[model samples]
Target: MSISDQIERLATAKANIAAAIESKGVDVPEGASISDMAALVVKIPVFTEEEVFLAAHPVGSYFKTASKGDPGEIYGGRWELDPSLGAFRWRRIE
Candidate 1:
């Protein structure tokens, strides 16, 4: 296929995947996981240990972490920031 045709196909696929996830009432942060996408499954992307800390401690001048190495680790493949608790909390991907 031509480069333009390939790009169009990929874009269409992405939109379809996103629409399918929304229909199932799921939210994908950043982007949907690749493995289960074709199945229209809500596969939440698992973050690396270091990435968790970085997210919790966003590097903007105004952002600060309560302490070092304290983004709270992801459990069961998903991590959510709980403002009420002021910490990262484990949440189910499915």
Candidate 2:
């Protein structure tokens, strides 16, 4: 498929995923992309100790920890400042 077509398809998929997440009563953060919400919803096991540690905390909780001078690691992911949101968002590495 053409690049534009692929992008359009992806956008549609993201919208659908976002709807599903909302239907589940999970709050999708403002300014967060659907893909980000999907990542939060679906937990693919990477079989690591860190993953276990991360599974216990809810999304965005780690940002608070990091802000207190702790390491920037959040539930097995990392926190990066999203300038658009003017806040730190959890980013899971795949």
Candidate 3:
């Protein structure tokens, strides 16, 4: 199934989901819409990939790998620049 389909399935989850997100520093409340969660994944981050990795992974450094083609074809993909977003992110290639 598609990511949208999977998201539709998770739309039925409880408020604890929002609580979990908020606990991590995001201000979203338990009443936030499911689309909010979905958007978080696809949204263009305000920070650069190196910044994000530094913030999340601390000691770890992120490496950039050239796309063999359309990255969506790879099974386990790595971070690549989304020109539209101006940030690099881990996009799952199915």
Question: Best-fitting candidate, measured by TM-score?
Answer: 2
Better of 2 and 3 by lDDT: 2
lDDT of 2 by residue, 1-94 (tens): 9999999998898777777777766666776786588677864333466656666544555333334332344333554444334444444332
Best by lDDT: 2
The residue-by-residue lDDT of candidate 3 on 64-94, one tens digit each, is: 3454353323322343433434334333321
TM-score of 1: 0.34
- The clash count for each model shown is 0, 1, 0
Q: What C-alpha lDDT, on a 0 to 100 scale, does residue 37 get in candidate 2? A: 86
Q: What does the lDDT read for residue 12 in candidate 1?
A: 88
On the 0 to 100 scale, the lDDT of residue 18 in model 3 is 64
Worst 10 residues of 1 by lDDT: 68-77
List ranges where model 1 is wrong by over 4 Å. 36-94
RMSD of 2: 15.5
**Cα miss at 44, model 1 (Å)?**
11
Question: What is the Å distance of residue 29 in model 1 from its true position?
Answer: 2.0
lDDT of 1 at 68: 29
Please, what are the lDDT tens digits per residue for candidate 1 over residues 6-89? 989987888777776766666644565555465546354556766665555443312224532322343222334334356334
